[model samples]
Target: MRMLHHGQASAQVDLAWFFRVAPAKRGAPVLVVCGSLLVSHTAKPPARKETKLTAGHRVAPRKVAGDLLVSGKAYANPAEYGHSRAVRVAVELGKWRKELAVFGDRVWLPGLTGSSPSEPLPFTTIPITYDRAFGGERFAWNPEGMGTGPGERGVRLPNIEYVERRITSPSSMPGPAGFGPIDPQWRPRADMRGSYDAKWLAQNWPGMPDDMDPGYWNEAPRDQQFLDGFRGDEAITIRNMHAVHKNFEMRLPGLTCRAFVKKTDGQLIELSMMLDTVAVDMEAEHTELVWRGATAAATPKLRDMEFLFTMLEPAGALTPPTGCYAIFEALRRKTYPTPEEYADDTKQAAKVRAAKAAEQQAATDKVVAEALTYRDTQMAQARARLSSYKHPSVPANAETGRHFSGIAGTIGPGIPEFGADIQAEMAQNWKMFAELFPSDDENCTWTRERVMKTHADGGDMSGANLSGLDLSALDLTGAKLAGANLSGVNFTDTWLQKAALSKANLSDTICKNTLFSSAVMEHAIFKKAVLTGAHFNRTQISGADFSELDLTGLNFEQCAGAQVNFSSAMLKHANFRNCVLPNADFYKAKVAGILFDDAVLNKASFNDAIGPGASFIRASAENLRARGADFRNAKFTEITALRCNVSQSQFDGADFSRAILTRANFSECKLKRSNFDRASLESADLSEAVLLEATATNVKFLRASFEWADLTGTDMSGSNLHEAGFFRTALKETKFVGCILTGTTLAL
Candidate 1:
């Protein structure tokens, strides 16, 4: 037999003496002879004789050649044969043959004999071949057939066929032989005998209860039960073990097996044998036996000796097989579907996406078609309207006698006779026609030459239909075009000085770099108009709707407007100097770097406006509502802002020097490092205001409340603080030198 060492080296070991010890009863003389015995031929052999020897009897020792012999009365106990109920012996002896003679002579016992002189005590002559002892060479030791009498059934191993059938069968193995509990009726497909079918197992296997199930194993939370249960240390251990199993391959170096014995009273004893380690678990006791060759005599005894099921070690690594426990778990969680089902699902999803795309395309096509129809209809109506404004023929003047050609040099040939009276009448007729059909369609076919000629002939073009006409670089001075439908007209670089455009619809007009100096454009609609770099100097635009516009860097110098809507407009760096814009709405306007110098902005709504670095110097902003505004670093020098509510605003580093801010609400304001020198803040509420390091020197603060105000490092020297409230105010390092502080409330 070949014995394998720790280094995987092989050594030849003769195993002939393994079955030499004969089975004997208790207190009986048993001989344990090892190795072959040689007798000398020179001397005659001693004859066998019967002798009565009592217990503990001893015989004198004798020697023949190199052989020594000793006889004594000895007893043998079968219970002391091995420590465990089963002994696992790993051997690789040569192929066994039938009828192999182990011993030639029978063992003679002189103590017990019958009266039969011809009969001798027989030695065990049983054949030890693989076919007779273990049924086949593939068979290993079976604890079920151990401790039986000397016969064919004693050495028969059953695990060879049992493992083969269990691994190759379509159905799951029986409960006692399987690793864990499984549904009895569940079976794998015929084609999945050698491979694992995860989908099939998921649908068939019974999972844990809803409270214990961990749900689908993915990287997100799906079910509440999974979120609650799949946490803490137990989940961490499982994840770690799973990762190790996936990353590393483990294998047992030596023989391994598992066996379980059932007692008569239904108690089971499970045993696992791996190399020299044996782990046995009984119903009440668990023990681990380590087999050291020299110390094998000290093992503890076990109760049961009969095994119900036995397992042989597989031929590969110790990693889980195809249908292992890990596979079972993944199947129960339904982590993935079968290949065929997945393909079908993908195809259906593609169809759904294609259908949705088709619907969206159809809707877009319908909208485009409707827009084209509307444009065509508007164009037709505009053509009909323009036809009604045909120019009237002029009568010949007798004084000039040349077909009324008083201004023939300017009027080209092949045109009708031109005269001041006829031109005046044509202008009046066109104006009346515009007032009759005043539609801001923007598709009016008014050529640039026609508009210029009408303006040149007469300045009375009131209620004219000049929509969408490009009058760029034209000087339309002193023109009367009030109530005109001038929507979408391009007036780029045009000088409309002294033009009357009141109630005119200039929606979506492009007025880039245009000049409207001294124009009367009251109550006009400038919605969505592009007025980039346009100048409205000295113009009158009362009640105009200019909301939500981008008027960046535009000029409104010396303009006069009342109730003008500039809400939500982007007015960055815009100039409104010397303008009068009372009750104007600048709500939520972004007026950064805007200039409102010398403007009359009484009762204007600048609420929620963000205008950092703005200059309002010498502006009259009485009763202004600029609450919650961001005017940081703004210049308000010499401005008169009486009764203004600028609360909850950020005005840090602003210059309000010599300004009049009487009865203003500056509550919850961030005015850090602001310059309020020589400013009049009488009866103002500075509650919850943060004015750190602000300079209010020589200022008037009469009856102003500084309650809950933080004035750290402020300079209020030479200021009139008469009857001003300083309750709960933070005045750390505040200077009040040379100040009139009479009747002031300083209950800090």
Candidate 2:
């Protein structure tokens, strides 16, 4: 669960719930004369795409630079980002500048052509929209078809290419979102469907060694016990999550409890797990009283419940436990009987059933005697015999035309039309009466609340042709929405916790801060969608297509994201720490200062990512495709940049402290002032490295390539430079502090 240097992970996605909602009420039809799966349904209106550079098909060299899409206020449609124009955006950071090159309708980011200029680099994200109408999903939502939003069709995203240029100033829009002064809307829903439940605890916690055995008592620390059970791995997530106020126990029969969870390794930890049985709770009046005859009547009335709570909590870091007494009050059944009382009632029920059975048997005997008297005189009619057996076998069914074993068999020749039918009716009546007053059989079953499954939408959409619906802030909490064509739906601020959104066409959807916690968002697309603060926490987001989307300022710290397509994404200042991002595409992405600490990003791609001064601290980036990354002065402390394809990267003034660069390919990269202190670069390919004024204290460069490297004014104190190639390299003013140089080639 560590970060990779410049790679993404690959893992299979598990299926969760998918939900959908109806279209929006307001807004004129903005989509004109087109059939797009990613288009929304609205009242008929003029059609003019507000985004910049829409393409009719998946264009070649996917990321064109000149005209990047601009995000602004929400206009007429929720799916649209207003004021999008094809303008060349240039960023100037400190002493670097990166400019977008434009050509007609085809716009391109700085590094779209897989080429980097030999200059100081500035960070920038250039968004491009598709022209073709978007298609529908699981097949349509893969890495092969990345960056293609709702307006475009059949677009393919390629591996990233970072633009290497000079920056003069940071090109970030600062401050809070323009929707007024920022305040977290604490919407504590009283409805249980969007809340918490015990089932979540049972499913998530299970009987792991970290479970707490808090027995039922008058006073027991339930909430404390719950927290104690998940103090290890899961507790880390809770510590970093959004805190909330809630009761610890079941307030109703069916309730769903939800608390914001913190991400761990780019994924939700086991601690943020929850039960989803009672998603919503109803009033007490909804639970009706039942009378099992007059002798047994039960009502769910509230009574005062006082339980003593005890918990095992640490007094301090290493202090003695301080056991204290506290009172907890609860509302429970007013007159609920214990097990002993219920058993006594069961005995009474048995007596009543036995008396009724006796009365029915006597009546059956009298009828049989009367029928036998006229049997011989009525032309040899079969005498009707009343069954008086106790505890009969299973009753046979006439429906299947088959006789089953261990069941009662009926014996007869043919039809006895009129009188026999009448007798059969009477026998059925007698059976019903006997069942109502059974003979000494009393069974108690736990009463469960019946869940209502209803939704509000016009016309059954299960098989309807629908598109272009604005489903912003939709409340389909537990609805099943798998395989639905969600081409043009706007799911802004929607609550999809534990819901399924798998294989849905979410192209061009605005999913800002949308809650998909534990939802199945696998293989979903967000091309051209503004997913700034969306929470896919702990959900299966593997294989999701996020290419060509506005993923700027997105914080995906510590989450599972294997094989997620982020090719050509504008991921500036995005935090992707400790994530599982292996085998994902980051082809030509404008990713500056994107955190990737403690993540498993093996086999991920960053072909030409423009990551200037980005952090790779404590990351493990194996087999990464970082062709021309601008790692100038980027922090890479204690990182495992092993076997990566970092060719011609700008590593000037980059920090590589305590890093493990085993067999890493850093051919032709800038290495001026780039610290390799305490670094293990054994057998690493650093051939043709521009190592001017480099520092290499305690660095193990055994069998490494320094061929033709300019190591002028460099220090290698206390370093192991054994079997290193300094062939045709400059070594002016270099210091070798306490270093070993066995068989090191110093050829001119």
Candidate 3:
């Protein structure tokens, strides 16, 4: 069918010939052919033309009986047409009889075979059918005109033919009258296209054209084929028909997809449409296309179709050919199987899922059962082992007493007595026994008689509580008085040689001229004690506390300990030669003329200590923290004081030759006339320090900071002062002869 513009000739019809073949009954079958004819601009003229004599001599044509030829004109410019070329025509042949019934049931036609004045011929009666004809039906038309029988004269009816023509009239065809502009405020009852589905379409537009179906339209090409189908004047007409159906016939399925009772109800309807099933109102939305146990599985396939529709709509896949809907529906059913097939597959899937779940549960149960069985077996074995076990028997009190008596009897004095000389030899055994096991009730109140007895009884007065006692001029040689509480006691001129006085508490005690040589005084508490002229040579005073005491002229030669705390004590002229005093704390202690020669004072803290003229020759005082200490005229020859912090201290006339003072912090210190010859002071901080007349010859002052320091009259000859800072320093008469001063920051 050729589509034509609006108001153009859509079809050709012969009323006279239609009346002859149609049945003579109301509602009788009558075919009305509605053809869509496209009028081309280059159409040829008609093949034949009727003479004027043949049209004028005929009796005045009655409007009711003759053929009503409705023709339309086409413009040269198709744009001026402003409508689709597809047209549809409808004629009610039954209605014609009702209108012309007043003129009798039958209409007569006069014969025009010959012109004879003498003999007048009779008019023939033409039977008119009272049949109803609907448009959109196929009908066959005879091309040959009505013929006359032999010896019977009759006028030949004109034959209707399909023709294409172009009209030159500038005036275009106006729309049918009595139609006004649609209301601008009109809106659709529902968002049909947005929430489009088969049920929605069926409810909102039951008579929707099969071509405009979503299943068909969504798959149609948006190219030339879509343009040709829904183009021109007919587009609005077909669109109007769709709108009328949506507005009047179809029910609103709400605006959102969630409005449906079942979430996938809309999807199922759409899928049914794609499967070529006629859509009807379902009892329950989900009941029409039952997936059995496969609704979830089938939803994705349905969504695929929805996705395809979404991709097509924006691309002008609106109107498509009628047969394409069928083709697409067929293809969709092939790709996604039917709902019955889907339900069958879902049933099988459900069985498989059930079987897997059951298998997993069975495995878990088996594991639990085995664990319980193993636990029972282990409990049984434990019970059997416990039942067969035996316990050792304990001896009775009488039996133990008898066995000890028999052992004593074997060592009893039942043999012949020894001579005087032999007995003298055995007397030494009593002395040995007394040393091994002293009297437990000695009271430790040392009278001269008790002291004589203690000396005679191996001098084992250990754990003696002799507080506030005077043991002056007492000789405790080779005594085992360990762990004794000798606090506030006097030991003037006492000799404690080779004594095991370890862990003795001698706090606040006076030991003037006391000799503690070869004594194991480990962990002894000697805090606040006066030890003037006391000798600690070769004493094991490890972990001893000698803080806040006057230990002037005291000797600690060869004294060894883990550490000794002499903090806040007086150590004037005291000797610490060859001492092993690691981690010693001498905070605020007076060490004037104190000797620390060859001492291992590693990690010693002498903060705020006054040690003027103190000697530290060859001492290993690594990591010493002696801040604000006075060490004037002190000797530090060959000391390893690495990373020592002696800042803000007095070091005037102090000798530090061959000392390793790397990374030392001597900031704001007084070093007048101090000698640091051959010292390693790399990365030392001497900021704001005074070094008048100090000699630092051949020193490694690499990366040292001397900012705001006074080095007046100081000698730094042959020093490696690389990367050293001397900002705003007083360098009057300062010597840097033969020094490596590379990268040094100096004041201009």
lDDT of each: 0.57, 0.47, 0.54
Q: After superposition, how far is residue 662 of candidate 1 from its true place, in Å?
A: 1.3
Instruction: Give all TM-scores, in the order shown.
Output: 0.41, 0.39, 0.41
1-748 in candidate 1: lDDT tens per residue? 1111111111211111111112121111122211111111113332222233110011101111110011111111234222212111111112211111111122222334422112222321222212222122221222222212344443222221122232222122211121111111122211112222443222211211222211111111011012121101110100001111211111112323333333435443343321222111111111111111110101011112221323233324332333333433243224344687678768888999999999999999999999999999999999999998966445433444674566676766644555766998999999999888857754456688877877899856678888888888999887788999999999999888888999999999999988888999999889999999888889898998889999999888999989999999999999899999999999999999999999999999999999999999999999999999999999999999999999989999999999999999998899999999999999999977999999999999999988668999999999999988775578899999998888764421
Candidate 3 lDDT over residue span 1-748, tens digit each:
1111111121221001000111111112221111111122112311222234112112111111112111111111233223332222211121221011101111124447533222212211211211111001111111111212221111221111111221112121111110111111111111112333554333322223233322221211111112212111120111111211211122211111000011223232121111101111111111010000011122111222231210011112332433334444444445565798778778888999999999999999999999999999999999999999976456565666778878988887755454666788789988888888758674335665576478668867788777887788888788777898888988889988888888988888888888888899888888777787888988987788888888888888888887688889988899999988888889999999999999998888999999999999999888888988999999998999898899889999999999999999988899999999999999999987899999999999999988668999999999999988775578999999999988764411
Model 2 agreement with the true structure over 1-748: per-residue lDDT tens digits: 1111111111211111111111111111110111111111122221333222122111111111111111111111112223222223232222223333211222113455542223312222222211111111322212122223343221222111112321212221111111010111111111111212343222321111123221211011111122122111110111000112111111111211111111322221111212211100011111110000000001011011121121111212311212121011111111344587668768888999999998999999988877876666563433333334344445434444354432434544445577799999999999999888846532222111101122343212232212355666766665456555556666688776766666666666667777777777777766677776877656677899888666777767666767988888888888787777778888888888788878778888988888887888888788888888787888989988788888788988899989998898887888888988899989998766788888888888888887546789988888887878664466788887677888763311
Candidate 3 wrong stretches, greater than 4 Å = 1-446, 746-748
How does candidate 2 fare on TM-score? 0.39
Candidate 1 worst ten-residue window by lDDT:
231-240
- For lDDT, the strongest prediction is 1
lDDT of 3: 0.54
